[model samples]
Target: MLPNIEIIVGTYEEFLLGYQLKQQSEEDGDQVVLKQTFADKSHAGSLKCVAVQGPWIASGGSDDRIFVYDMRTRKQSQILLSHSGTINSLVFSPDLTHLLSGSADGHMIATRVGSWKTEGDWQKAHAGAAVTHVSCHPSSKLALSLGGDQVLHTWNLVKGRVAYKTNLKSKSTLGSAPDCLCWSPDGEHFTLSGPLVVEIWEIKKAGVARREKTPAKPICVAWLNGRVCLAGLENGSIVWISLDAPEDEAAKNISAHEVRIKAMSYFDGTLVTASSAGELKIWSCDIEKQELEHLTSTNIGCRPTCMALLDLSSFKSECPQTSKVVAPKHTNQEKSNVVAAPKPRGVVTIEFEQDENPTIEDDDNSTTSDDTDSAKKSKTNHKKLKQDEESVGQSDDDDCEKSDDSIADFSDSESFGTDGFSNDSDSNQRPAQRKRRNPTPVGAKKAKPKQAKKE
Candidate 1:
């Protein structure tokens, strides 16, 4: 595998840094190298969180907005603006079709990836409390979220509604809600940790399977190969919890860095970690033996808050970001709900094509010719339109494609299931939308209505 194929993107201070892990020669200590890609301010405020799936990357900060980017093109794709509070967490479903974002405003919303439209949202997902973390099941059907109210919420992705909620403040033994929540690689269990404790909970039963006291204050957690869970601690050490054998919990605790490890992610036996000291490290793990051999490390200039890995191996195709267009919705058959097993095919169907027929409406400064003259209605909407001449306000592809800003629109339907996870093509779902219309062919005058001549 190429060393730079998978890039590590981390949010440090107000900037976003990208790094690639290169394996060194065996003779030279066999260290892994942390090479920098870009280090620039990506948000107006300190970035709080980020989520990555396939070629799509999203980052949110105190700026109260989410910016989605296409890794293939390295360009900003869409700006999500539904939250009224600082964004806290973001998660893409295993299927890549759903994106769940939580904010300080106590709202967790599910959005369709390609359409970028709000699928189903819980207005008070956490009862007006900030959502701390969200983890979805491998099946992509169920999701669990931890809120500031010391409660946990379970959501049905297919139905876009709350499946159930557990109040931790009233029932758990932790004395307080856990700071971080994570699900295992398999769907059998999940873990909630805070300070000196880590508790594994069974998903099907919604009960604690076991609890282990950490030697150090646990900061974050990530699972590997569906059998082990690694918890990064405030003491700059790692405590490995064995899921395969409950009695072997905390069998290995090793010091990793000199500072608090804030974030970590695992992929195919490789691990990437970010620390409060603005440092990044790479390691190769032997899952059977529960070992992490350090390869290399590097320090940016500022402390990082969160991190995620973007696996490039999945996009080995000729056009990694083969763009797709969004046009007006048309008549088509509906599709079923989503399906998944926790791999990188999450974005296989996602497209990031630049709008070829952009209209004046998308521009912030463009004005309309509404009152100028009914005679000019047949002419172009505005001058210097960055639109395709061959297709004026029409989709080049037969698939329904709308403009970027027009991609997401709220439907007043009672059930969010059809809109949230349905496999139906978008064209079949937008029968009531009237925002866009096919413009008359150029040079064709508007024909007046017919009248009676025998009067």
Candidate 2:
């Protein structure tokens, strides 16, 4: 099973876009929290996009400017004026040294992290409509961008050149723009969500290898444990898919919210999904075994526009003499990664074999203590095995009807809700007063940090 989860909510008064941060956390699973609000100036347009580096939070608004804030000091550090249209998305390099900003003007700019100054660094990244989303490759020197032209473009970041470009044929049917793109952890596939359906594309040689559709219109996609793909659906449900399993493995759906799912992120084994209703639901997954368990669900009171995970180890190492003592070794392992059962190859086929009924027992009792432990483990495994059998049985029936449907079958009819802010907080309103609440420094929080609670 995946690890447990702790949730932090960024209760924003307005629709937020591009609000993501990279920081060190103090709490175990809930290390990162929305400690403060900076630059409430609504005039910068609708704070449409945000990106986080170690200590800096970079955000863009309708004002066609990029603003960088220092989280530690709780102050606006820098602002850059460049885009002619509203900024929609911002992405930071894996190393957090470079920033990429996408705007409605059909252009993208790459700037140094600390200083938003762009001299010879800016590149005309896209040609059609607006650049909707930008993603940096996990292990390669490449990056990908989705454009309003219904095309996916790949870039060679080091050479600053286009490597490949492919139009999303499924998107053409919707006659709308692509809004978001998510790359799988292994960089072998990616998902595009917008205007009804979530399309999964396998990275092929200069083209798409294969594509699959889901039931709900997807707004965000995240890789939970390098195996399963978690899709935040517009219908307030979170769908979990085991990529290793066949296309019809009965997508696991959890009713996570009452409104549209706006953003999602996964760390260790915990899945954090935010909705337009201002609720954040955390789900746990067993990636290898293709099982999902609902964990704690908390209402953050205000809509969460964006979310990100911050590793606590990075914070503790920064200070050694804090009064807050770190947890024991067991706690460290629990916080390090998502726990998933080892995936059984071809779950559908395995179910058939087990259902046929064949049982055998060994006649050895000399190793009594070890044998008892083995028996308990076997019992837990058997329960999970039975569940998979049922899932496969149900999926077989569902697949028959869906086979004739086109690739667009996954799209759903759902409209984006009105912006979460009140009528008084329209686009014309100037940015409002900023409220700052600095979190306790890394070493001054709780003691014997709680273990990430498993589902």
Candidate 3:
């Protein structure tokens, strides 16, 4: 199922490309796509982010503009311009009716699909800082924005107001402002990462559900499942944490790249990660085992800034069928006789009639003499056990009562031990009495006695 996907990669060199992979044979691995689509200088910028849905792909970068392209036409259809600063992030709504963009100018604008008009007033999302990343909730009705001012803002698209805002600075230490944000598939929780900590939060709560210290600087983060999160570190490692475990325990770390990880995405059961060293790796995620199996790696010869997975199921309806490759025609073919199974006889019928009333039968009411005798013996044994337990309990209670009644008489009659002192009174005071007795110094003379004075 994953092999049918098409990958679109945006690069720091201002290049936007598409790739289609296929398996030529069972023994060999997948064949990488050599043909790619390139953009001209009219749409040039260091592509910072990209988003794909159905047959549409949107990219933004240093140009302060977004280029929306159609895969079926292989051309750019529209260019949106509303940002005063560089576009840092781009995301399409879950239903693909609106495109949301975050810019370094602290503004978030949503535009409709075909109209190319702004839907509502552009939000001044972060007052004094750039919006680093933004993600749409699964309902497509809310958007989450992470900003450099150390705040997370959740916007209500329908009402055109800020639904909730959370400050992500750590209370104990001050350097853990969030740099990236990812919403879970179920939309009940989200994750934030920066500096040394990764925190998971419930959508409705004001406090974090769990916070964990990472081994390296987490640059990007993604959710692998409901309970597990994958963090891409600056040192080319991916740390996997199980939120169900204690916060202080060690997380499983996998060495993924030789340099800082630039981007990562998980679709269906496959994971794709890229590094600054120009290496792209595909991994198969085992959800049940909580493990990653390395599938293949490709040297793209260029650093990738962002990546997106495109499902081409909708493209089949728009494109011509001849665009697909076909096997060569065989010249000399031999024909062979084939047999076909016979058809079944026409509509065999059966009939059934219902009875008004049915008689019931039960055999458990009768028992043999031996069974009755054994049952009686079992009842007697149970009764005996109950009596023995109750008698033992009553005897223990009586012994405790007797001890309580004799306490005063026992204390009045002073009893001495082998040391010739009452055990009850002296036992509590021996340690204090030992400290009061003075012992002379090892090498000092004894003190002289004092004489009485006359009036």
Q: Which candidate, 1 or 2, has the higher TM-score?
A: 1
Candidate 2 residue spans exceeding 4 A from truth: 1-44, 72-74, 119-124, 169-175, 194-196, 289-295, 315-455
Task: Identify the runs in model 3 with alpha carbons over 4 angstroms from their true place.
Answer: 26-42, 170-177, 314-317, 321-455
lDDT string for model 1 (1-455, tens) is 43345554556458777887766767746656667766656578888888888788888888888888777766777889988888889888888998899999988988889789997778788888898788888889999999888888888887888888888886555557677688787888888886688888886676987777887778888888565788899989888887667575445787898889999888876787878887778888888777898866788777888888887765543435557888865444422333436866332222223554323333333233333234254345553354565465454442244553444443434434553544455756644333443456799999899998996
Over all chains combined, what TM-score does candidate 3 have? Answer: 0.66
TM-score of 2: 0.58
**lDDT per residue as tens, model 2, 1-455:** 32322232333454332222223445565433332333244343446666665666666767787777655554567877777887878877877767887888877878877656763233456665788788887764788887777777888887877887877756563346775577788888776665655556676654443344556677877886555677878888777666676765566687777778888877877667778886656556677665656655545566666665543323222223448778756566676775778987542211112543333343243454465557668988999999999987676555544532331332221221244233463566553222223345687856786799899
Every candidate's CA RMSD: 34.8, 47.9, 34.5
293-408 in candidate 3: lDDT tens per residue? 88667777777888887877657535455677888654444223334579986643332235432222322324443455576689789999999999977765665554433644
- What lDDT, from 0 to 1, does candidate 3 have? 0.75
**How many residue pairs collide in each prediction?**
8, 17, 0
How does model 2 fare in lDDT? Answer: 0.63
